[model samples]
Target: MPQTVKLRPYRLADEPAAVGLWQRSWQLAYPQIDFSQRLEWFREHWSGLQLDSRIVVAECETVPDHLAGFVAVSPRTGYLDQIVVAPEMQHRGIGKALIDAAKHLGREGLYLHVNKDNSRAIAFYRKSGFTIAGEDINRRSGAPVYMMTWRPAADLPPEP
Candidate 1:
């Protein structure tokens, strides 16, 4: 049977698992980042921030206890602050599911920044309909990043 994954709103209790997944994903993607600094950054950013930010977790039906991936979005600006999938579970549609869920929330557009050196993410986002809007140097890490956005396609009809 195919694995069933469900995306649900994030809760306070999910922080530990979410942070773990974030750390693991970051390490895998940017091995040069210092572990301590990365953890500290996550603590500050992911802590008791606005709950209105749509943070969703992806959990599998077979391994309900584990989170396969997660996506954090800002409703106001339609910015996808974070999207991470466990390295072992990637390329299996979890990331796409997360993005699809965010799009269904009626966002006018979606935006995110991917490290310029992270070609894997850049390609993935491009495949998912995101286009490079600009580039910037991350203030924290001084890394070059590509800002991407996904707007509603002109060919699609507007919602009633």
Candidate 2:
């Protein structure tokens, strides 16, 4: 069984761990991209989220300081800018926990753009109650992507 993980507000001190996790996770997903080259790229985006997003980190139950995963949601616009889980910690419910956290943060609705080729992530989002609402290209990499949105069950429209 997977160990329990506790979610908490992100602190300034968590930046290094959080960013490291971000890089490692992305590197595993898109190995062709050298994420290390984008450290400052991530820092710029992280700085923006730090100012306006509701950032939450999942802490390992037994290993207190070990960050298993994290999610960042813009409270004002409900955009799920980032959700990452450590490569070693994938599929242990950490990602789901982070999604649940983002759901609570974006009470009305949540929206995000996901890489089109990442079927694993796309399937995960679909299973999480998010539907593909549109399509677009990734601004940074110009890769094709899909727009996904999610709302609380109670807020969903009645079935036909």
Candidate 3:
């Protein structure tokens, strides 16, 4: 059985673990990419991340300080910028908990961009109630992607 997990605000001290998990998770998904360069790129840009971005990290009950997953959201627009779970921690509900935390921030809706080729992530978003709002190229990575949006179930239109 999976252990309980707690969601908490990101702290300065948690940066390394969070970045490490981000690096590893992306590495697994995009093995063809130059991860070392990507890791360094993140390290260089992480400090300049917008001050209004909200981040939540998941802590597992069995392993206290070790982070299992994290989600980042834009405070002003409720744009979900990133969500990554350690490969070993995937399918353990950590991602859902982090997303739930984002929803509790009082946003009526949330949106994000996901790589088009990442079928697992696309399926996960679909299961989480997100609908493909549009399709475009990710400016940063130059990859085709889909813009997905989700709203509270109660806010959705009634079924036909």
Identify the candidate with maximal TM-score. 2
> What's the TM-score of each model vs. the native?
0.89, 0.93, 0.89
Model 3, 23-117: lDDT tens digits are 88888899998677888778766664537677888888778789988888876787888788888888777777777776765267899999999
Q: What are the lDDT scores of the predictions, listed in order?
A: 0.81, 0.91, 0.81
lDDT of 2: 0.91
Write down the TM-score for model 3.
Answer: 0.89
Residue pairs in candidate 3 whose N, alpha carbon or C atoms collide under 3 angstroms: none
Mind giving the per-residue lDDT tens digits that candidate 2 earns over 92-145?
888898898898888889999999999999999999999999999998999999
Which structure among the candidates has the greatest lDDT?
Answer: 2
RMSD of 1: 2.6
Ranking by TM-score: 2, 1, 3
lDDT of 1 by residue, 2-116 (tens): 2677777887888889899888888877787666567877777887344547788898778866888888888877888888988988878898888776665535889889999
For model 1, the superposed segments whose C-alpha errors exceed 4 Å read 48-52, 154-160
